[model samples]
Target: MADNTSRIVYEMTISHAEFFRTLPAVMGALPYVVDGSEVSALQDTRRLKINLSPEGRRNFGPIPLPVTHVELGFDGYSHEETQAFL
Candidate 1:
């Protein structure tokens, strides 16, 4: 078995005001978890950069990665990197 100690925590936030006024899409975004903190919005970016060492060789697949890894000043996941990540 592989060790599970390394963790990645992402966090992003927007004022309630931001989602209030500029909301033609927000009306249809409720069904999804995109309030206060979330991912997969309306944008475009194909990237999957994972660098692991021999000691950290493990599978991160079943794990639900966070969207806060995107940092800030970006939109959302308009596209996903459907590459062979194994």
Candidate 2:
């Protein structure tokens, strides 16, 4: 398995309105993990560069992989469940 422990994490936030509007688009961007603590409704101005080792490339695909639009899929969650959680 590829080693993913060396990845750089950048935490950011946006308005609740903007987040909702962009959530679908964001979900299609890349391979990432979402943590409860990482959710917020305020803007955070911070950025970081990611340096991927060979193993990271194998795990995450190419460094500049193009993302095609994908329909959002919410598995096993009702509308109310998703709204309440968000």
Candidate 3:
């Protein structure tokens, strides 16, 4: 029998702190990203621009200051699995 699964590369932008916090939760909730796809890949790149002003500092604080971008690739995910994941 031949496999009928498809691959997808999902990308999203979020806060640095939010990403770290959600990472584990997403993993626990769904193992697709964590379990590893046929050629699963992940990339995290922190925003280069940083606000040094007092207001910026006060609003975002220290830990959650920068913006983070994530890219994930999932291979061999079935239609039902993808639907459930979404």
Local accuracy of candidate 2 as per-residue lDDT tens digits, 17-79? 444456556445333343332322211222212221122111234443222222222334445
lDDT of 1 by residue, 1-86 (tens): 12212223233233334433444453353332244433333323322222212121223587543222222222221222221111
TM-score of each: 0.18, 0.23, 0.39
Cα-based RMSD of the predictions, in order?
16.8, 15.2, 11.3
Per-residue alpha-carbon lDDT of candidate 3 for residues 25-77, written as tens digits (9 for 90 to 100): 55553333322212132223211111111112223544544433343333444
Q: What are the lDDT scores of the predictions, listed in order?
A: 0.29, 0.31, 0.36
Q: For this target, which candidate reaches the highest lDDT against the unseen true structure?
A: 3
Better model by lDDT: candidate 2 vs candidate 3? 3
> For model 3, what is the alpha-carbon lDDT of residue 7?
40
Candidate order (lDDT): 3, 2, 1
TM-score of 3: 0.39
Residue-pair clashes per candidate: 0, 0, 0
- For model 3, the stretches where C-alpha displacement exceeds 4 angstroms are 1-13, 29-68
Q: How does residue 8 of candidate 1 score in lDDT? A: 32
